[model samples]
Target: MGWARQKQQHHNAAFFWRYLLMASALCLVFFTPLCRAGAENHRNAYATMMYMGTPRDYEFYVAIRVLLKSLAALHVDADLVVIASVDVPARWVRALEKEDGAKVVRVENMDNPYKKQANFDKRFKLTLNKLYAWSLVDYDRVVMLDADNLFLRKTDELFQCGQFCAVFINPCIFHTGLFVLQPSMTVFKDMVHELEIGRENADGADQGFISSYFPELLGQPLFHPPANGTRLEGTYRLPLGYQMDASYYYLKLRWSIPCGPNSVITFPGAPWLKPWYWWSWPVLPLGIQWHEVRRQTLGYSSEMAVVLIQCAIYIGIIGMTRLARPSLSKLCYRRSDKSTYLVQNCLKLVAFWCILAAYIAPFFTIPHTVHPLLGWSLYLLGSFALCSIAVNAFLLPILPVLVPWFGIIGVLLVMAFPWYRDGVVRALCVFAYSFCCAPFLSAAVSKIMVALQLTFEREAFLPRLGESNPPSGFNKLY
Candidate 1:
């Protein structure tokens, strides 16, 4: 009788396991079509690029119209969706609406915060309004382009890429500028909710909100294209033209190069005053005449020298701080018995000199204009060095304190359940390496370089002073 009972129990367990496996298979089969259908409905059959701005801004209108004309030339066959928030005179909106392939969407919810001129806050409100307008559109693939952006080449190939979400590599953060989204009203609503939450939490700018939710909204469908001009391989795509950030151009000089034919120039923030408007003519390479034409027509290049100078100053400060840490530490020890005023003064002076040197390096190398290769090299090298130092100085010191705790957690997770050991162990390893080891390793390298005095020299390798200047025909104002 006991043997018979044991056999019955074994049969029951086997039956349960078989039932579970069949159920899992059935669920996968059932949802496969639904998932595929959702993706298909949002695929890039009809592409639309949305620009939200007030029509009353004449310069912005001119920039948008020129961009539309360029897109038309490209034979994109995609609709240009422009959302006008302000009370654009009926005539102006009508004129743009009458354009053959352009769709002017008027958003009534946009509030004019300032009674006089629109400011950053108003722009944010306008963006939200435009986002709402996008929700109403029935397009499959939607891209949000800043009005300052001028398309120099055809972007139909971008839609040809079989990705649901595509974005240009955002140079500052590990993100992108021109994002190709699978348009859905639900996703748009979720984005608005997240933005509202960000505003309430004081998390960051709107872009921050968007970036934070990017992983969730796109759900592993998100892709970052390669550096402009690279051939697409293994799902990696590039933008049509170089998408420029006005702030990066003016402040960082990171996007001054016309990397390839399909590069689109994008200017974040105010659209009217762009560095490219001034520097595009003289600096543009001979083969890239289309960019020059776009710059001439739109009157902005998304490049600026002042911003580049500021970026250099920032890099210099970071470099000097890293370089002077040892000296400062010694000074503190020597002055322990006395007032620390002398040491403080000396440190401040060092910082000031470093910043001044950094600021002036660009001027001495390339003054009055911008050079793509020289500018990008300085920006990249300086940023890399600064990041290396930052990691070493800040992150390395905390590793020893955290490593044991991380190891213990890893062991606990692994021992807690043998069935989930593989995934948990892999996750813990990634967390431990990323949070604990990477920073220390980077910092150690930076410290070693500093000790050897193998510092990066900005002026020696970059473009020499007066290499390029603003275009002769460029207007100071839009």
Candidate 2:
């Protein structure tokens, strides 16, 4: 009996050693970079696609600038980096660079071969651009944000969290909008590998990909330390306060600590109904706050300057094109004909005029300026109100479709003259919206709308693009 027991003990000891060896190797693999960069600068930034010169991209750009200001407001001033696409407008890129504490890091759009091979354009809505977070190695840690998020208070303590820490958004997932991460090329490459192997999440973007990558993550409890008493290389759950949604604004007063921070308020409403939807504020919660953010980050004068420059450049481009190829005038401006549908032309004309006005009004603040507000407000609210009475009582099912259609089509139509005009400008604007902004917003809005009906979806937003200065004509604003 003693001999048999001794043999069994020896076998158990060997197994324990093997497990220890593996665990140690993992620690070395993951924690080495974290240790080396422990004293380096950390960053807080977001990713947003900017191509189409659309108002949405402008708003997000302003949001990033404001976010950096908010960080400085809390005295947690660190490097503010914006990872953007290669062809984003020079104006937008320069505007970001001009911000007091912001830097724009341009990156190429990384494609998911699996999504393309599967012909899953609609299904593959989440951006692969966010994978660049792994490559932001200059900073020891990074707090990646969705440009739409508003910081209610200081959140500097987030840096104290582990390599991968996020809030448990649902029973099965964690919020990505505001998370603490120690950027690692190793982890980033692993994500790319997963994508190459056709392992994608149902929701498409980073959240699902991240959740799937760290399956054991859901088990980690929030507001509690890990079993080992320190943050390890693996995934972790952050406190609820780190990433709260709009619902938290009222609910948090009761549960959140009286003076805690980040209490990061995520605007997870329908994409079009954002707080700063200048024309309309559907939720009636913080529409004013949204505008206030715009006001803070992009001053009235700066915004005006940007608009005037755009108008001048565009007018010049149109003039130059017509002069260069007289025949192109026919394509640039269509003759008024009875065949033109009244409704379509009216809306298109209204949009065209509105773009002109949006650029012009910043130059001269006139009483009639309020007319555009009234008109646009009527349009957006009327549309939302009319749709509110749809057959289903929950929410407009087509809200998702309309939001994206507006951005995609709106962008294309703005430069409808096609190659006859500034094709470089048009391509950049469209790509930013289609590849980056529109896709992310559509998916988020679709998810958020459903969550509102079922459960308010708490998730993160990632900015995924790169950019350099645009051409000389339109680079005056910054």
Candidate 3:
């Protein structure tokens, strides 16, 4: 009986052990989370950009997409991400995911946290949300880059560096672009706290917060991990290649040491020098590479597209105006004598059409061999076009398209040609020959000009034959 009892107990114990082992194996095979394994596999740090909103925000997103495509083309293994707010259109988000195989992380829009003000208009705004980048704990390390940054060569080795690293943007100032950082919410919170209570920097936006937080560390030696598996904490200055400013690069060649093969080229500061700026091609050759990326990948010049749409809308309004008025199109720009023939009238109409075409030409294609003055005109014209399209104050749809050209060309004509320079006199001469249908349009515009002349200088418009410049009748009219 004792031998049988001992054998039964041993058999039960073996069965229990077998059952436990089977369950453990099944759990190990089935229940382990793939997320952890996937994350562990992709342990390398990532780079990201931010764009909250702009009138031309679409172009900005397209630029980001182009950067990602460039990375893929080079067969770079690093992931590129963009954290945008709800203000960014949904189409931009989809493009980032579908076309570029990039990630789009949406965060709430935050205002500029830094209290400091920039001395000049810095072309970019609402960049304080960059702080949220540090909150992405998924990435063991992160390299934050400005959306305007274009990568030239592979910078994957940057991940081997320490937690905090950046390049000098301004003299003695570290640029936030292309900075390596370890993801931690604590750092994010501390930045927020500093922004709220601490003094803001002179440059404003993200530069202030980053510069303040990492002060006196520009020249500091960074953490160099020893072969024995231990690490130290320090901030490292990035090589010039990482944050190469385009303006400063040329300036260095002129006055200072010219830098070598830059890893990234940062087009910052001037709004016009940006890759997708309206006059990017002719105004600044530096933006051409970025412009090419935009054209080849996106299928069109993104900046010119916005201008084209605005022009089309203006044309539609002009067409509708012509349809409604009927007589306006047939009328001549000059009120010429038509008793013998309408030849001069026809010539006047032809000149008006030519002027209209001239206005639209620059938006379509900038001439490669333009004079310096024409380049300046393109630059000015580009600014006026962008602002006019985005402006709410200009209710007259046609005015945006017409006014800038007329203003620039008219001012030029006034300077060189005697007729346009003395606008009021020319306007009066047209009014004097008030026999044609075009005279009414001229008369209305002339009156507005005269009113402006009187309002500001009160002597810009010369008085009529009977009245003084500041007429004695002015008091009675009031």
Candidate 4:
């Protein structure tokens, strides 16, 4: 009887062990995947917006691409989202999704109800589209950004912020250039309703509308992401370090913000100076930094071909003009005083137009979104080549014709002077340089006029303005 009882106890113990093992396997098969799905559903995303119809739509396209590619390079453990307007071209949409790895959220452009606001800028009409970020309910947290925000590091901890948070680059008003928000369909609907009602928007743009919506954000304590990996709830004021205005560094020539991670730099100032314009640099020294990120990512290849083609065209103009110089001079003729005067006035008018063209032509040909050095270089080259044509076509002095070219190079040097203690000093130096150049510029203008006048006196007009023999001194024009 003792042997039978012991064997029965052992059999029961083995059965219990087997049941426990089977239950554990079931949990692994079911519960682990659920946990993963929960984590994914609570995913974070870095989002920015792009709308069409603006004069700078393509520029912003490139800017958004750079921002997305830069974030990808940081290897942030979050999705990249572009809240692109529906009007954005299909090819651009495909590029953003396939090449840049951004999830493009096509949205309709939100009309600004506050368009009548006295200080509204028309360019920001569609910035209201940024409010669509709140409708991205699939993302637990979204750091909605402006394309000008330059990230210095992975700010995944921004995901830890509550429903809404933004950096106050100004004391009273928080900048909308970069902000953290929790996605909520309810909040998005309310924002849309507010837009319909024409809420008190100071700037008639997203910055004003959003700032008014979260007016109390200024009172919230600065957020500090808990070390235990817990996300916070409710509105908060992000430290200034998160959206450190690029202007702050200009005064000190360095970043000195003592709070939070100085992870992103925002250019909330002038639209033309927003880093990617190439001409924005030296003025905004941080532009080069933006370009560096672009160099590593999207690159200038999109515009490089245009630039190369332009350069080729300019070079051809110069070469062909130089070779055709003699033949062009042969077209000169002699005639009566009245006819000569009429011809002279016509030539002067044409020469003035050509000189103006020399200065303005490069503005259209060179890519507007290139590096400052490259942009300025192309401008100077284009100007020189075009000016050379005017010199060969009209009997003008070379030095006076090239004076504007020298002035541009000089202005660039002054603006690019690296030793200025602050922006004020830099501005003063530029002013002084310009003041000094005014006299030289005036003299060059006088010289150019005199040269034009002499051309008509020396190279006489034909009976019909193109029939007379070339003058004895006509060769000097070349």
lDDT of every model, 2 decimals: 0.45, 0.54, 0.57, 0.85
**Residue lDDT tens for model 4, 1-478:** 9999999999999999999999999999999999986544438899999988778888889989999999989988888899988889999999999999888899888888988778988888888999999999988899999998899998999999999999988999999989999899999999999988878898899999999999999899999999998999998999988988988998777789998888999888888788998778776778889988888898888888998998899899899988987323345544555776686678778888999899998887778898777888888889999999898888688898888789888888887777878778888888998899889889988998887766654554333344454446643433
Which candidate tops lDDT? Answer: 4
Cα-based TM-score, every candidate: 0.40, 0.51, 0.56, 0.84
| Candidate 2 ranges with C-alpha deviation above 4 Å | 1-55, 114-126, 223-234, 248-262, 280-282, 302-478
What is candidate 3's lDDT per residue for 1-478, written digit by digit as tens?
A: 9999999999999999999999998888876766545543354445565565465565566667777777667666556677777767788788778877777788886656443353623444677778788987877767787768877777766665576888776778888866888878898888777766755666666776678778876777643334554433556776676667777643322213243346788886665456656445433445656755555555443345544555565556445544553221222122213421244334334434444455555555543222334444554555454334322111223443344445555444333333333334544434444434244456544553343333223321223223223344442321
Give the true-structure RMSD of model 2. Answer: 25.7
* Candidate 4, superposed: residue stretches over 4 Å from native: 1-42, 326-346, 462-478
Candidate 1, position 447, lDDT: 55
Sort the predicted structures by lDDT, highest score first: 4, 3, 2, 1
Residue-wise C-alpha lDDT for candidate 2, range 266-314, written one tens digit per residue: 7665666555455332223345565565565554554455445544554
RMSD for each of the candidates: 26.9, 25.7, 15.7, 7.6
Any idea what lDDT model 1 has?
0.45
List residue ranges in candidate 3 displaced over 4 A: 1-41, 113-125, 222-233, 249-261, 295-357, 360-478
